[model samples]
Target: PGGAASNKTYVIYSDNAFPPYEFLDQSTNTYVGIDMDILAAVAKDQGFQYEVKNEGFDASMGAVQAGQADAMIAGMTITDARRETFDFSEPYFEDGQILVVKKDSDAKDLSDLKGKQIAVKTSTQGAAYAESKKDEYDLKLVYYEDSPTMYTALKNGTDDACFEDRMVIQYTIDSENLDLKTVGEVLNPGDYGFAVKKGTNPELIEMFNKGLANIKANGEYDKILEKYGYQS
Candidate 1:
């Protein structure tokens, strides 16, 4: 578990549109984001190489589970349920969920969203958090394959609100000038981890952990976060 396989270029799957975490840079037409930078930095530090696929998060999860991808580094939460199927590395980032709505919408919080359509990216922690309160709030959920589409639904009045990562939605709102605002307190605060299928690639996890530690110690981790305009 201490060293990676020599000359093996691991296949890593990741979200295609999870901005700040993972997203396409249109100007260069290449993938670039905090997660991408961090992974590259860590791999360089640990003397390993990988190829990342910018598939959606759900697809990434499925790919890893099906043994099509060696690992994943999307902005995936480290949940106990997830631990059952995937082994995760030490946490790399902390975040929480927030409810977002059109800026002029009257909904001020979860209580005001009763029976309203709530958009969610499928199979995300944000989706799970909304599911837990669906009954209590009488919420109707609308699932999308990715965040940008879910946000589009909310902005165009197709959905009344959406639950998303606090940092992610905020960045999208600011960068894209989307007419959306957060409405509720943060929920399900947790850390993001790199993951691989459980009981497989223990050495990869070991390399990731060691590389993450080294990057954090040598300041590359902080630089990566700051490059994305996120405070480390």
Candidate 2:
């Protein structure tokens, strides 16, 4: 069943720093992105009123777990550990980890990054992946609170490289006219989904899935992706 008009408050938690996925438009001081657009469409189709809060990614996850937020749409990757903590809707997008470095840098692949300092967001899958191969690559990891900080560190030569979602990193590089290039290939290709508290709200999950399907079928999803320059 849909939510009652009088009881129509649902909050989504997200970290607004991830570009193309979630970010603030400086000109209008409004939050806009593929994630926000998709979620709004889903809520309208499912008959629920909702709002998004720009918080840290880990905090967003915690909010859902604590029932302070109904769900999270923060470009979170589906992982075994996360699944154990929350229920996820069907994947809304496919993403993968990639390395970003100075466009003229000699690094061509992960192997070339041996013994180099790389920046990654703390508590994120990118950090986890880098840590997993820390010993093998003899890598020194620099952790930041968010993507912007990581990018800044990379720009200032505080770090040799930064690892992040390919789509987001690409978007940033182009938008900012940063002289950065994505290295060799994507690691840990994964799906992104909305997350809700585990073992509750089956109806809400069903409604989200239905709405997602409708949006994709009607080409709204593609349009949103293109709006963000994420389309190939």
Candidate 3:
């Protein structure tokens, strides 16, 4: 792997505020999290160098699609819709959507939210999931550009509740000491993958898959997850 192209530093984009996946480390003034650590470990194992841009998730997706960035690993779910535009590496993690509301909320399930507003992040699985249930639940959808703002909307009463990744919302609640809680069962259970524009950088996907397998076998992957309070 010690070749000329291996020395090239690729550009990797990720979300700026999705904690446990990717987020700014204020004390160090740098980005760090599960996705960051996994990318660092995988690049090292596969002998590649990269620079990560902590752009918000939607912007990161656009950057990769527009060829402005080489790849992304923003806890992006691997779905048929995204597959049409991006080539995803083998799944690195599993996740699911969850309904989140304020801790004092008496919402036991989606039925309790009838005619209420639900917040969703733009161009995300959470948004899609909420959209799918909108008419069935007589819900109104409110869009936010990022996770923090979406959660803020829920907390400030701009929206009654929101949909978010199960682990992501849980992590944010614990880390920020927020008064939020998830209700109902997980939905749209799926896996997350590293991605590049379709057919543009198959080599990058290859490297990621290879390094991922190696790390999973050798225990680095589990260590990274456990570092962020996850059990493999």
Candidate 4:
């Protein structure tokens, strides 16, 4: 078991809501997802014990910076802005931001959303992307703390559409039977990576990178992603 102490133990921080990446199984009272599985595999291959703890995304990053957590395995995008704050391992997955709107809505693309209300989670890559286009589209950006609340704002007619990762929005639409559909092509093709506090564990980061490369080379990576319905 991984925990906060001992040289053999590595603390991992992740939010419990990003499906296919990390989420709680209420029935089993345990965290399970592609992220968890990959971490477990990496730990086994690298001969280290790791435990994952649920924490908000930004908080997790902060924990790593503060030396409270050894690393973070959240579904964090590798943005240039983020690179200035922490070091990221080689990307383990690639994803992109997509638009989600109620079925039958008038909004078809960013152009169609001129003067429209849009919802996005604050501080996310999606939000940054939206913010960049806010002026061009004449959009009113509504920021939420998390994905669930942003979806809620759209469902309750508080916003015209929500922007987030395609996989996450797709999972919610299917699981909740939401009257929502993804629109247009994905806007930003981004890579997700494990984050470590700057200058703390080069050795551990090297080990994780090696493990990740092994998984991809050996086909375990694709198999795990396929199990979660991720095409890429």
Give the clashing residue pairs of candidate 2, or none: none
Choose 2 or 4, whichever is better by lDDT: 2
* Cα displacement (Å) at residue 15, model 3: 0.5
Clashing pairs in 1: none
Which segments of model 4 are wrong by more than 4 Å? 1-6
Question: What tens-digit string does per-residue lDDT give for candidate 2 at 52-161?
Answer: 99897878987899999988899999998888888899999999999889888999876898999999898788999899989999999998988998988888889998
List runs of model 1 lying over 4 Å from the truth: 1-5
List model 4 lDDT by residue over 1-232, tens digit each: 2212236777889876888788888899998899999988877766777788987676787789889998998888988888887899999888899988988897788888899999988678888888999999999999887777888898889999888898888887887798889999998889999989878777778888988888788888888889888765
Question: In terms of TM-score, how similar is model 4 to the real structure?
Answer: 0.90
* Model 1: lDDT to the true structure: 0.92
lDDT, candidates in the order shown: 0.92, 0.86, 0.93, 0.84
Per-residue alpha-carbon lDDT of candidate 1 for residues 1-232, written as tens digits (9 for 90 to 100): 2345488999999999999999999999999999999899888878887999999999999999999999999999999999999999999999999989899988888889889899999999989988999999999999999999998998789999998999999999999998999976788899999999999999889999999999999898999988889777
Q: Could you say which candidate leads in lDDT?
A: 3
Give me the candidate number with maximum TM-score: 1
Candidate 3 per-residue C-alpha lDDT over 1-232 given as tens digits, one digit per residue, 9 for 90 to 100? 4222565789999999998999988899999999999999988888898999988999999999999999999999999999999999999999999999999999987899999999999999999998999999999999999999999998888899999999999999998998899998999999999999999988889899998999899999999999999889
Rank by lDDT (best first): 3, 1, 2, 4
TM-score of each: 0.97, 0.92, 0.96, 0.90
